[model samples]
Target: MRIKRLVQKHPEEKTFWKNDQWFNVYVQVNEEKRPDYKSRLYGEFDRFGFEAEDKYASLAEDDEHNGWRLFRRFKMVLHNNKRLTKDVTVKDFCGKQMTAFPLFVMSIKYLREHLLQAVTTQKIGIEETDILYVLTVPAIWDDNAKRFMRDAAVDADIDPARLKLALEPECASIWCETLGTDVKGAVAIAGSQYMVVDLGGGTADVSVHERKPDGSLKEIMKASGGPWGGIFVDENYMKLLDRLYGEEALTDLRKTEMSDYFDIIREFEHKKRTVDIKNTKHVIVRLSVSLRDLANKYSKQSLEERIAALDSHKNAITPKGKDKLKVDWTVIQSWFKIPIDLLIQHIKTLLAEPKMKRVQTVILVGGFGESQYVQDRIRKEIPDDLKYTYGTNVFQYFDENKYPDDKKVWENGKWQVPFCFKVYVRVNEQVKVDQQMTKRSTPNSKISLTAVYRTTQEHPKYITDPGCELLGTIELENSTDIPFEQQRLETTFMFGDTELFVKTKNKTTGKEAYMTFECFT
Candidate 1:
């Protein structure tokens, strides 16, 4: 049977999941006005126990009187397992004794960046109904972080109930649920566990589950995270480069002369996170010249010789335009090997416990997890009895074309490997119902056919005679082609019980505006 899925518009704002291969739709009310950015950050700060400087009468008075002054410089919220309660008497303008709650804000940049991502995602959708998911560390629990998430829901035009804020660990749990696997513990580890490790950036998070008689998995332990990740290693490498190049010389080079040159270096580092690199030589040379130029006052090394060395050292790293820049993993490994060895030791310690040993599988997750060097190292170091799993490695069940020779087998169109789950996504119907059913925004949607599919396992046995059918992935296109002053779209993919929604919105009036939908099954 031929089926077409029309996610009319604003797929960016919706969430998706795959079930008996049918689409379940949910709509979001995209807000018309931009929220007061400062207020939202204030809400987060307040939640984190960072009190306004207004707590001090003089500072409070100054801020109130000075309209243009941004009174708060930085704010942070930290979670503590301890409880402290204190009340202080302060005199108000009315000359009455008032009690004030003392508070402090945590200035952690990482936490601040996350709050910004959530806020930006809420405001900048190309479509009104775009869906976004933000990742967070599991154990770094803080009340203010939760408050920021709550504020995001309040600021959004869509039904606040539809927006979700998940601990990185919990998202992993949801992924496990999506995969339809109960193997949280032994013999097989699934996608969610791996996602947590990735979110953590470096730490290998392990979750154990019990396979029930009906074949569902239960939580063993959520997973642990550490500050050790590839980014941290990158910083270490930057420091090493500075030391090797001579620190003082590098700093002088960065400050005075060619500033844009250093920016390119950071760009290269950012590109490295996305793919593998086998070399970094020539790029380093260009950066070296830029740095030297920046130090216009001094010439430590003759420019010609330095440039020559840099060009000659083609062994530094290889750049692949955008996808990836290559760097010698061997050199990087040599510098970081001791720390990597130390990290492996810690992982081994956790895994060596009797309960951990019962873990059937170990999964590599995060950007670093994708590193060919790391993978090779882990495989070489691991005992023969242990094995690793990657999401990219498990594609055989879903797309045979991608893995034409995938050894994994499906019985009756069902994966024997277990953990196979469904995905579902939802977005709003084109029509809007305020107090009365009406068109709030111009109907901006398109309709098209894309080969879509869902596994038949989640289907009810009584409803249809079923084994497994390749329910083609429904590509959404609006048939009416209703034009909105602002065009937006949301697409959802439901995998098992959980839903992932992506949404994008664009101003139709903008000079450069065109709509296109790229759907993948």
Candidate 2:
């Protein structure tokens, strides 16, 4: 007998909503409480609308941190008036039954508007012409994902054309580049060879890179992803709580007084992210309050007596959100063993493979990579002979894709050099070249200087394309010759390797050109 499972097709261009105005939109969704949160919440996003601001706020903080003084103010407003939920929602604000997406979208919308304001004033780093990259989960990808992205992008004042949506796996490559690790043919070097394991709340992604002598690095990025990271552990903690306190107890608390239950759960999550012990104690109290309130409503016991009973079972009622936590450390360690073991097994297999046996080091990165438990487990599993490095703040380099050849050189020195020099372009043989192209230009028009391109000997690895050399920038000796609008020097560096032609345009509009002597390897 043959069996069939359901499959969904990805959405095409119509997935995005359109208006008369032009805008670039980029959106990515992840599971709110899980890795698959964004997928489950897609339909709801249509009814409630996307909020780019909240997503930005959520991203700014690790988790549980609502942004800053602004967040505190918003929290107060939401707390004082539950009707604020109704204001934000198109439908009735049903307590406990309320979905997480609406709030998430609202937050994103708020954050994006704030960011837009700053951008208008030229306060933020994100420029009007910059393309926005929205991070999302791998599970809920398809037409729905595209729609959500476009919705969010439009709200963020970004043009949909300029917006690029990518999964975390693909973003890992960008992260490497943002950190100045992206290079061509870099895997051959010793210091440059290492795996980038991005273990975050909902997923874990891995990539490998090698450094090149020309100050660049190359990466071995994987294509597959799965549900393996922090959210699963959080679910485990929830299950444990349900087992001890009785699921009914939580149901009652959420139904009658959701804020109370949400407060406790939210605080517990905050503690987990912060690793704060005092917060853990508060979680115990919060849970105890719920238990006491439920007991008071059902039994003849006094609130004080119910509270006492809760304290007694506190050992069994584990708090995962905001507290130092009450669960056995050994149990927590064992709970994570499954995913940890999987990672270890994969690493072991990769190392055992004949091609990877020579590998000497591993680099740990991402949100979950910061977990003390994960670090300890990796340390205990790997051989002492192999080296390890942790990317303490990988998010800081999340946007890095343009990598120089040398990591050490880029990290240590901030020297300016003429990058346009040695840059080269190959014009199509069929393409016409005007030898006196500059002569036709106006007096204030830009002209190309003597281009200095990389020699085959200087970048041997890049010799795959023999004619592809580095191209240089044009220089105007006379200051008055440069016009205000023409101050920008634009040149297209052409390159081709028989099959296809490639061109890289360099626009030096406002920044001064760097002067440095050329060096050969």
Candidate 3:
């Protein structure tokens, strides 16, 4: 009943249909001495909640109770970069140990239930049967790794037929097709060849695609990527923190004061997006109060004293109060250089390949793609002819101009009117009439006619007089074959005819309308 009401409210719903919706599931091991495994669900869901909480919590937990014991990264690396062996064991947040394969299966099951609950609450009528579960893996993952992921999804209660393992870069490429020309820039148009650079927290995946005539895409190059991504940048930042305050102190802070550790990284992530390489100003890095106190207890001097010494050596460290350090722009740039340089080199290798020679655009997508520093570096270092664009820009462009008037038939009334038309009629017979009735007696009473005669003869007209008798009227019926849903009828005036004719055309059923009229005397 609700769906019926929705359809009535939005009569255009009949035009849109989709067989399935896909959700991307990413798995990782929590940060611990023996790390626990966790997973995050992406695509068409509350990504903000995932980012804030850092992990998928139970569906019943309130917002405040979530995100505790959340490990920010994963360490479940496959042996030989392939399948997971039977010996792989990981700890959960409960400190209980389980094999990596089972952990993945459990995480996926949680994600599945959460998504199903969401769909049920929304009353979208999307059952588990309608969903196609797609798990995205780094391009570096081999066939065995893909198989392991597929098996895990099946173990999570997803049908084997419904589960699919997708390469990250390829998935990003497919996503790019849904983006607009503005966000994607000029390169997103059909027939243009481009590469998708998916830079996420843990890995960077790259692949090339050529837009097809039908708006679909075809892969032109094999997927390629590495572990060089946002996580590496975070790692580099952590190394800097280790240098500022003793590494042991930082480690202690991570173990004993994880909330503060998460805060520090969260601040760094915010600054990383706004960091400008062209600006040579001092960038401030805030240290957690707990971290500063721990560093002071373990170091040779107070944290401030060490910062002063570093500043004297042009290391550009300035202690701001007891909890913040002012870092030189050059130092911050150095931290970005490691990951940016690696990403550039990887892109260079991709560009140099024979298959990639024709790539005209480079699309930067995913979490790390939001980094202004990363975007600036790639834009500058890459060849000038090859345009480098971000994923968000593409979506923005399309969102603004999603429905142009020319593409909408209903908006332009293309369906209601005939595309083009011709008129033809045969004269049935001529009858004798009274001479007085034939003559135009009164200017007001005479009907004016405009006619284009096919033969070199004058056209005749009917005269109305007091002596004229009324004849029976004939009405024409609309065609039954026309799809009433897609079209409507209109009355139009024509020249050279006194009779009214009806015509109907079915755009959906491809049925033509025949014009017929009856004459009465």
Top candidate when judged by lDDT against the true structure: 3
Residue pairs with backbone overlap in model 3? 29-74, 183-393, 183-394, 184-394
Off by over 4 Å in 1: 1-136, 140-165, 173-196, 199-206, 210-217, 244-263, 266-288, 302-330, 384-521
Order the candidate numbers by lDDT, best to worst: 3, 2, 1
lDDT of 3 by residue, 1-521 (tens): 00000111233222222222111222222323422222221111232234534433332133332223332243435423443664455543324333456445656776888889998999876778998888888887777777777777887789988888878788887776568855465345677788889988777788888877787778888787777778767777787677678877877775566567767988998887777656648778776789988987898787666656653434577778878878887777776687778889988888778776567667899888888778867765765331110000000111214434332233233322111111122232221111011111111111212121121112211112122222222222333444344443332222111232333333333333333332211
Model 3 stretches astray by more than 4 angstroms: 1-70, 79-83, 90-98, 183-188, 308-314, 386-521
Query: Candidate 2: minimum summed lDDT over ten consecutive residues — where?
Result: 386-395
**TM-score top scorer:** 3
Candidate 2: give its CA RMSD in angstroms: 25.3
Q: Between the candidate structures 1 and 2, which one is better when assessed by TM-score?
A: 2
* Candidate number with the higher TM-score (2 or 3): 3
Q: Using alpha carbons, what is the TM-score of model 2?
A: 0.44
User: Whole-model Cα lDDT per candidate?
Assistant: 0.37, 0.42, 0.54
Superposition TM-score, candidate 3 onto the true structure: 0.58
- At residue 141, candidate 1 shows an lDDT of 46
Clashes of each: 104, 63, 4
